[model samples]
Target: MDPLERLSSPAPEFLDRLAASTRALHWLVALPVLLLLLTGLTNFWPELKALHVGGARVFAWLHVLIGLGFAVALVPSVIAILMRRAARRDARELLAFGLDDYLWLQHRVLRAAGLRSVGPRVGKFNAGQKLNAVLSAAATAALMGTGVVLGVNYWSKDVFDVDLVGAVFRWHTVLSVLLLPLIAGHLYMALLNPGTRESLRGVTTGRVRRSWAERHHGAWADRVREERRAGEG
Candidate 1:
């Protein structure tokens, strides 16, 4: 039997724990962004002028602190990703894809728009998830770049022109706005999608239905069964 096959078959408990951890991390990251956005709006919206400058300063400081917290969370997130990569490499299923996965993507999109007759069978992550991952990485990089520029502008206005800083700020705001919709979609999919909802349960309880594993990750499920059989043999 292939070593990859052995590794791909995650125990139900293991998959559950991993999903829960990932979701918790997501919420951890989102809370700070929400707070930062609220504080940011006070600075940007004149209608919010009732807010005192002192309060604004406090919010600004809080935003920076929260941003720092967000960065810190990346440490654990990076470690998890590395672990996942190792697991996938050993299992030969990192970003695993097949005809069913692609068909699932098409079906999901059609179903979303009320056009598909039947839903497609998805794998661990759907096409939308892959797209979200790419977008998130890009957004995080942009946010970091813009944040540095804005932070430095306070001391070296000449070196980092006020106009340039302003432009970066706009980009930062736009990116943040764009993320809002994506995040909402992600949440809905996780919480509302029947197939995905069970997978999400692993986040909180660290366990999923055996049936779910078989339906969504058939290949992975088979690998696990094979491993178990080999071990028994």
Candidate 2:
């Protein structure tokens, strides 16, 4: 088979499975986050609190329930990353930001504005994606931490400082609000941007057009191709 043909073919079989697993994990985490946000937002805006009868009570109960699910959903993914060597390796790469990523972001910004035709070769996750992942993870951690404080205040006695719990709630709300735009941008890129929409296949079908991978994630594609060749040999 020609190299170009290989370049446009479906990703390696293992990658498809990995993508599918991680995608499921991602949705597991994302769903509860969405639920918590919707329920929690009503509590944040006083006027909106009256939108539904007993809305305050409903939102409070739903928020805590959803927050529990959100925290629990994170555990399986963490366990998977720890148990799977490949996942750990990939996670490391994803977390490591370097000079190439900086260049990629610069090019990406210019390209997005229609000012440039090309940019640096991106890896599996582009710079923006990496940064978004980091920020989202941070937000999740903060929410989880503050959520525990809120949970304690609700279930237990006033052993801890009431003022401290209040402070935690404020930070939690602020972090939640900050994450909204980041999540929105991620969704828009994955679902709307023509150039990036195909990447969503990684999460959906655990496969994507080789051409899409080559064009958008050139560095990763090159690594994939090399690995394929090595395996064939």
For each candidate in turn, the TM-score is 0.67, 0.83
Candidate 2 TM-score, true structure as reference: 0.83
State the displacement of the C-alpha of residue 79, model 2, in Å, after optimal TM-score superposition: 2.1
What's each prediction's clash count? 1, 0
Mind giving the per-residue lDDT tens digits that candidate 2 earns over 111-221?
878895566788788888789988998898898989977876766657679888889879988998899998889889889987778767777777777666776788888
Model 1 collision count = 1
Model 1: per-residue Cα lDDT at residue 149: 67
lDDT for model 2: 0.75
